[model samples]
Target: MQINQLTRAYRYDGIDLPIPPHLAGDPQALRAYHATLYPAILNAEAIDVGVAGTVHVTEYRRAVGTKG
Candidate 1:
Protein backbone atom coordinates (compact mmCIF):
# COMPACT_ATOMS: atom_id res chain seq x y z
CA MET A 1 0.00 0.00 0.00
CA GLN A 2 1.12 3.50 -0.74
CA ILE A 3 -0.06 6.97 0.21
CA ASN A 4 0.54 10.41 -1.23
CA GLN A 5 0.51 13.79 0.48
CA LEU A 6 -0.39 17.16 -0.97
CA THR A 7 0.98 20.40 0.48
CA ARG A 8 0.40 24.01 -0.48
CA ALA A 9 2.19 27.13 0.77
CA TYR A 10 2.82 30.76 -0.08
CA ARG A 11 6.27 32.35 -0.16
CA TYR A 12 6.06 36.05 0.48
CA ASP A 13 8.69 38.49 1.64
CA GLY A 14 11.02 35.55 2.35
CA ILE A 15 8.45 33.89 4.54
CA ASP A 16 6.43 30.74 4.09
CA LEU A 17 2.75 31.29 4.73
CA PRO A 18 0.34 28.48 5.27
CA ILE A 19 -3.02 28.47 3.57
CA PRO A 20 -6.15 28.85 5.66
CA PRO A 21 -7.98 25.59 6.04
CA HIS A 22 -11.19 27.11 4.71
CA LEU A 23 -9.52 28.43 1.58
CA ALA A 24 -7.15 25.56 0.98
CA GLY A 25 -9.41 23.88 -1.57
CA ASP A 26 -10.10 27.01 -3.61
CA PRO A 27 -7.05 28.55 -5.20
CA GLN A 28 -8.82 31.69 -6.37
CA ALA A 29 -10.33 32.30 -2.97
CA LEU A 30 -6.98 31.70 -1.31
CA ARG A 31 -5.42 34.30 -3.56
CA ALA A 32 -8.10 36.79 -2.70
CA TYR A 33 -7.58 36.30 1.02
CA HIS A 34 -3.83 36.40 0.79
CA ALA A 35 -3.93 39.45 -1.41
CA THR A 36 -5.78 41.27 1.34
CA LEU A 37 -2.92 40.57 3.72
CA TYR A 38 -0.07 41.05 1.22
CA PRO A 39 -1.13 43.03 -1.82
CA ALA A 40 2.02 41.86 -3.61
CA ILE A 41 0.46 38.41 -3.69
CA LEU A 42 -1.85 39.73 -6.34
CA ASN A 43 1.05 39.33 -8.72
CA ALA A 44 2.46 36.21 -7.12
CA GLU A 45 3.72 33.25 -9.13
CA ALA A 46 1.52 30.20 -8.84
CA ILE A 47 3.49 27.01 -9.29
CA ASP A 48 1.84 23.63 -9.44
CA VAL A 49 3.66 20.51 -8.40
CA GLY A 50 4.88 18.32 -11.21
CA VAL A 51 4.90 14.55 -11.01
CA ALA A 52 8.20 13.53 -9.47
CA GLY A 53 7.93 12.17 -5.96
CA THR A 54 5.41 10.94 -3.45
CA VAL A 55 4.72 14.24 -1.78
CA HIS A 56 3.13 16.80 -4.07
CA VAL A 57 3.71 20.47 -3.39
CA THR A 58 2.03 23.64 -4.61
CA GLU A 59 3.88 26.90 -4.05
CA TYR A 60 2.93 30.53 -4.50
CA ARG A 61 6.01 32.71 -4.84
CA ARG A 62 5.69 36.45 -4.36
CA ALA A 63 8.58 38.38 -5.81
CA VAL A 64 9.52 41.00 -3.27
CA GLY A 65 12.18 43.44 -4.33
CA THR A 66 14.89 44.59 -1.99
CA LYS A 67 15.98 48.15 -1.58
CA GLY A 68 19.62 48.45 -2.48
Candidate 2:
Protein backbone atom coordinates (compact mmCIF):
# COMPACT_ATOMS: atom_id res chain seq x y z
CA MET A 1 0.00 0.00 0.00
CA GLN A 2 1.16 3.53 -0.66
CA ILE A 3 2.49 5.51 2.30
CA ASN A 4 -0.13 8.21 1.96
CA GLN A 5 -2.84 5.62 1.94
CA LEU A 6 -1.55 3.75 4.95
CA THR A 7 -2.43 4.81 8.51
CA ARG A 8 0.00 6.88 10.53
CA ALA A 9 0.77 6.98 14.26
CA TYR A 10 3.43 8.05 16.72
CA ARG A 11 4.48 5.84 19.60
CA TYR A 12 5.83 7.62 22.66
CA ASP A 13 5.70 7.17 26.41
CA GLY A 14 4.01 3.87 25.72
CA ILE A 15 1.08 5.73 24.20
CA ASP A 16 0.07 5.98 20.58
CA LEU A 17 -0.60 9.39 19.17
CA PRO A 18 -2.52 8.78 15.98
CA ILE A 19 -1.67 11.34 13.35
CA PRO A 20 -4.55 13.57 12.45
CA PRO A 21 -5.62 14.20 8.83
CA HIS A 22 -4.14 17.69 8.81
CA LEU A 23 -0.70 16.44 9.79
CA ALA A 24 -0.76 13.22 7.82
CA GLY A 25 2.15 13.76 5.41
CA ASP A 26 4.00 16.37 7.45
CA PRO A 27 6.52 14.75 9.75
CA GLN A 28 7.96 18.00 11.06
CA ALA A 29 4.52 19.39 11.78
CA LEU A 30 3.45 16.26 13.59
CA ARG A 31 6.63 16.33 15.69
CA ALA A 32 6.12 19.96 16.55
CA TYR A 33 2.57 19.35 17.66
CA HIS A 34 3.47 16.23 19.58
CA ALA A 35 6.32 18.07 21.28
CA THR A 36 3.83 20.53 22.70
CA LEU A 37 2.06 17.65 24.38
CA TYR A 38 5.27 15.80 25.24
CA PRO A 39 8.28 17.95 25.82
CA ALA A 40 10.61 14.95 25.79
CA ILE A 41 9.86 14.56 22.08
CA LEU A 42 12.12 17.51 21.38
CA ASN A 43 15.13 15.40 22.28
CA ALA A 44 13.75 12.23 20.80
CA GLU A 45 14.24 10.92 17.28
CA ALA A 46 11.68 9.40 14.99
CA ILE A 47 12.33 5.77 14.17
CA ASP A 48 10.29 4.40 11.32
CA VAL A 49 8.94 0.92 11.81
CA GLY A 50 8.02 -1.12 8.77
CA VAL A 51 4.36 -1.37 7.86
CA ALA A 52 2.12 -3.33 10.18
CA GLY A 53 -1.28 -4.21 8.75
CA THR A 54 -1.02 -1.28 6.35
CA VAL A 55 -0.27 1.15 9.16
CA HIS A 56 3.00 3.09 9.31
CA VAL A 57 4.29 3.29 12.85
CA THR A 58 7.01 5.65 13.98
CA GLU A 59 8.51 5.41 17.44
CA TYR A 60 10.04 8.32 19.28
CA ARG A 61 13.24 7.26 20.96
CA ARG A 62 15.00 9.43 23.53
CA ALA A 63 18.71 9.55 24.29
CA VAL A 64 19.60 7.29 27.19
CA GLY A 65 23.40 7.54 27.45
CA THR A 66 25.22 10.34 29.26
CA LYS A 67 25.60 13.41 27.08
CA GLY A 68 29.19 14.25 26.20
Question: For every model shown, what is its TM-score relative to the native structure?
Answer: 0.60, 0.81
The residue pairs in collision within model 1 are none
lDDT of each: 0.71, 0.86
Scored against the true structure, residue 42 in model 2 reaches a CA lDDT of: 95
**Error of model 2, residue 27, in angstroms:** 0.7
Q: Model 1: per-residue lDDT, tens digit, 1-68? A: 97777565555565666688989889899888878888877887877645445544555676669857
State the lDDT of candidate 2 residue by residue for 1-68, as single tens digits: 65457777789978998677888788899999899989999999899877888687899999789878
Indicate which candidate wins on TM-score: 2
lDDT, model 2, position 3: 41
Q: To one decimal, what is the Cα RMSD in angstroms of model 1 from the true structure? A: 4.4
Candidate 1's TM-score: 0.60
